[model samples]
Target: MPKLTSQQQYNIEQVAATMAIEDMPLTERAYKHLVQQATGEKTADQIAEEIKKEYQNG
Candidate 1:
């Protein structure tokens, strides 16, 4: 994965801090997972399909 700039990391930290307590962990995890998927390890279509599956399962 490409390295995030200091500014980008700061922004992520700020957003994570603002998230609701119950949602913070999941949101952070999903954000990191999606970033990984986006940066080339996984295709966009695959990510969409996974999100769809999650929604359907819920």
Candidate 2:
């Protein structure tokens, strides 16, 4: 994965902190994957489908 800028890294860290307190929290690694998917070339629909497939299989 490409390196994130300082601001980007800080933003993701903040998001990670927020999600940590949620009822169903994702690991930091999972949040990193999410950031990657959101910034990647695929359309939103494609990303959504990928998440859905993973959820079903998981």
Candidate 3:
């Protein structure tokens, strides 16, 4: 949605490269969230509703 600065782009690339061979929890979390936003069909309201349900259930 927004443009990454050159340094930010390089940092992501570096994290991705490390993730290719091993587990990087924070990076993995960030990557999963990024991919979810990139491909998701749900709106922010929908996601928030889901979270609300989860919290209510728990």
Candidate 4:
């Protein structure tokens, strides 16, 4: 893994804190899972299309 700059680390910590306060466990889990899937793997458009398909089919 690459090192995060101090600003990046701060931003991540802020987002995590906000997520914790929101108490959105499922959303947080889904977001982390999607991020893992997305990292250097899928383009933004492809990910959006896949999500749209899932939402439509579900």
Candidate 5:
């Protein structure tokens, strides 16, 4: 994995903290996807399209 900037790290930490407080169960794949979105490696539209494709394929 590539090194994340401070802002990306902070973003991910915030998400983790919120999930912890909410008692949410985050899978490793979900965590990685969140990191990708948080870091701007994937845009919301892109993610939505991927989800659409996955749903359609399945």
Candidate 6:
């Protein structure tokens, strides 16, 4: 994998430090697809909804 540039690292760190966990949502299609592959049996929307529900209930 390519190394992250200093600016990219800083930006990621800033977001990580300031962003609320609940505010994050599954917006990346590629990641949703990966979730499908990892789980072996679920649509992306299903996965996203399940995550949203779990986070909301916590």
- Candidate 6 deviant stretches above 4 angstroms: 1-40
Model 4, residue 28: distance off in Å is 8.9
lDDT of 3 by residue, 1-58 (tens): 4455676566667767777768654455466444444445445566667768989999
Candidate no. 3 TM-score: 0.41
Pairs with steric clashes in candidate 6:
none
lDDT of 6 by residue, 1-58 (tens): 2355676556555554554475664345534444454445666677778878989999
- lDDT comparing candidate 2 with the true structure: 0.70
Tens-place lDDT digits, model 2, residues 1-58 = 6666787677777777787767557775567576675456455577678879989999
**Model 2 TM-score (2 dp):** 0.58
Q: What is the lDDT of residue 45 in candidate 5?
A: 83
Candidate that would win on lDDT: 5
- How much lDDT does candidate 5 score? 0.81
Which should have the higher lDDT, number 2 or number 3? 2
Higher-ranked by lDDT: 1 or 5: 5
Output the better candidate (2/5) by TM-score. 5
Cα deviation of 5 in candidate 5 (Å)? 1.1
Candidate 5 per-residue lDDT over residues 1-58, each given as its tens digit: 5568898888887888888889986778777777778777898788888989999999
Candidate 1, residues 1-58, lDDT tens digits: the string is: 5676676667666655667455655465567755655455667687788889999999
Computed on alpha carbons, the lDDT of every model, listed in order, comes to 0.65, 0.70, 0.60, 0.60, 0.81, 0.56
Query: Any runs in candidate 1 off by more than 4 Å, and if so which?
Result: 20-23, 33-49
Candidate with the greatest TM-score versus the true structure: 5
What ranking emerges by lDDT with the best candidate at the front?
5, 2, 1, 4, 3, 6
- What TM-score would every model get versus the actual structure? 0.45, 0.58, 0.41, 0.45, 0.73, 0.35
On TM-score, who's better, 2 or 6? 2
Look at candidate 3 and tell me the lDDT of residue 10: 69
Q: What is the C-alpha lDDT profile of model 4 across 1-58, one tens digit per residue? A: 3355676556656666777889854465455544544354556677778779999999
